[model samples]
Structure formats: structure tokens, C-alpha cells
Target: QGLRRAAKVQAGQKVLVIGAGGGVGTFAVQLAKAFGADVTGVCSTKKTDLVRSIGADDVIDYTREDFADRPRRYDLILDIAGGRSLSHLRRALDPRGTLVIVGSERGGRWAQGVDRALRAAMLSPFVSQKLRMLVSTENEEDLQLLGKLIEGGKITPVVDRTFSLSEVPEAIEYLRGGHACGKVVITE
Candidate 1:
């Protein structure tokens, strides 16, 4: 819902989601599809099937190809796996497209992904495309809306693995390894 709300996605818009096999990316793909957009998911080769199964019109294996080099441009691009430069991402966006940076996985402790997001904000006004960052906010209204969508069969949560409370450390290690296919859950 955050991505949808931030991007203001519309019907028939071509949307691209990076890290589509991960937790947030998976939800973004389903939400965009539910919103009636033509969705494309980008992930590593091993996770292509998972992304496609979740309703992506197309899937790009980042390990096999660079989505930026593709001729096609998206009306909206969601960057959740933030390793690429802002300039590289802009190349894949339509001139008037909107790019929402959902998360960043780069840099050291001081700035990390925040630096790239800041750069995007600084550069946005000078460019034709809309570049912005998303900090997800939880509220009852949005939760109710998401629940309705889930009940209506428009969206479904994807849980890749579950761990006991005692396994929290291991769970974090697993996530840091980047092998999980979807959302990780911790249960008591």
C-alpha cells in the first residue's frame, strides 16, 4: 500500500519493482497488480519463478541481465533493493515516470542508503522524472484496505520461512545471507 500510495499507480501503467522476491518487493508486486498496472519484477535468477508466480507480467533476472540496459521504460519504478546508482535507475524510467526508493542496502553505518535517497531528492527537481523515498507508515485505514484486498483475493502475503523466538539470531543471519525467497516470520 505504501508503494501504491507513494507512486499513485494507475491502471495500465508499466511498473517495475526491484527485489521482487523479497518481503516488501513481493507485496509491492501484488499491490501494483491489484491496482491494475502492468507489473514487472526484478530479482536474481533463482527467484524468477517466485516473482512470476506472484503475478508479475514479466520478470527480470538481475544476475543474468541488467534491467537498465533493456529498451523498455517503466512509468513507475520501485527501488527496494538499493544497490544501483540513482543515475542508473533513471535510465530505465520513462521521462515523466516516478521512481520511489523504498529501501537502501548500501554504505556504512553513518549514512547507508540514506545518502542515495538524499541525492535522489536533491536531483529530482532538475530532472523530468519524479524521484522520492518511502518511509512506510502504518495506520488503521490502510490496514483495513489491505485486509479487504486480501479478503477479496486481490493480494496475499508470502511467507518464505518461519522461525521460533529462540531462532531470532539465526533468522537475522539467514536474512543477511539473502537466500530467503519471501518474508521471514518469527513465532513464539
Candidate 2:
């Protein structure tokens, strides 16, 4: 819902989800589809099938080609696995599109994507496109809404692996290695 709310997604819109095979990405794709948008998922070659199976109308393999270089332009772009710069992302976004930066895996110790988000906010007023960052809010209403969506089969959580209490370290290592297909759960 964060992606949908941030992007103000409307039916029949063109939506692109970066890092569409990961935990958040998977949900984003499904939610976009539920909103009746034409959804495109971006991921590496190995995860393309997973993204496609989850309801992405189109799947772009980042390793093989950059979506920004393509002829397509999205009405809404959700940058969940942020590695691209604002300019790079803008290239793929429609002139009046909205870009929502959700998270970034790359950055210095001080701040990850926070810096980029700030810059986007500062620059938004000067540009035709809208660029903003998403800070998720937890509330009972939203939780219940998501629950309904899950119950209705509009969204499903993807758990790639689960580790017991003793295997926490190994689980962290696996996450750091970036090999997990989806969410990694730690069980007590």
C-alpha cells in the first residue's frame, strides 16, 4: 500500500517496480496489479521468472538491459531496490509521472537512500515529474486493509527462507550475500 499510496496509483496506469523479486518488490507487483495497472517488474536474470509468475505484465532483466534505456515510460515508478540515481530513474519515468523511492541497499555509513530522497524532495518543485520518498506508517486500519487484501488473495507474502534462533548469524550472512529470493524470517 505504501507504493500505491505514494504513487497515487490509478487504474490503467503504467507501473514499474524495481527489484520486483524481493520481499517488498513482490508485494509491490501484486498490489500494482490489483490496482489494475500495467505492471513491469525489474530484477536480475535469475529472478525474472519469479517476478513474472507473481503478475508482472513485463519483466526486465537488469543485468541484460536497463529499463531506462528502453522506449517505455511508466506513469509510476517504485524504486524499492534503489541503486540508480534520480536522473537515471527519470529517464524511464513519464514526463508527468511519479517516482517513489522506497529503500536503497547501497550508501555510506551515515545514510543510505535518505540523502537521495532529500535531494529528490528539494528538486521536485522545479521539475515536471514528481519524486518523493516513502516512509511507511503502521496503523490498525492499514493493517486490517492489508489483511483483507491477503484474505482476498490479492496479495501474498513471499518467504524465501526461515532460520531458527541459533541460526541468526547464518541468516544475516545469507541476507548480506543477497542470495535470498524473498523475505528471510527468523524464528524463535
Off by over 4 Å in 2: 109-112
TM-score of each: 0.95, 0.94
- Give lDDT tens digits, candidate 1, residues 1-188: 44667789999999999989998888899999998999999999888999999899999999889999999999999998888888899999999999999866656455764888888888999999999988788899889988999999998899999999999999999999877888999999
Q: Which candidate comes out best when scored by lDDT?
A: 1
Which candidate number has the best TM-score?
1
Looking at model 2, residue 154 earns an lDDT score of 94
The global C-alpha lDDT for each of the candidates, from Candidate 1 onward, is 0.90, 0.87
Give the clashing residue pairs of candidate 1, or none: none
lDDT of 2 by residue, 75-156 (tens): 9999988778899999999999999988655664557648888788889999999998888887788788778989999988
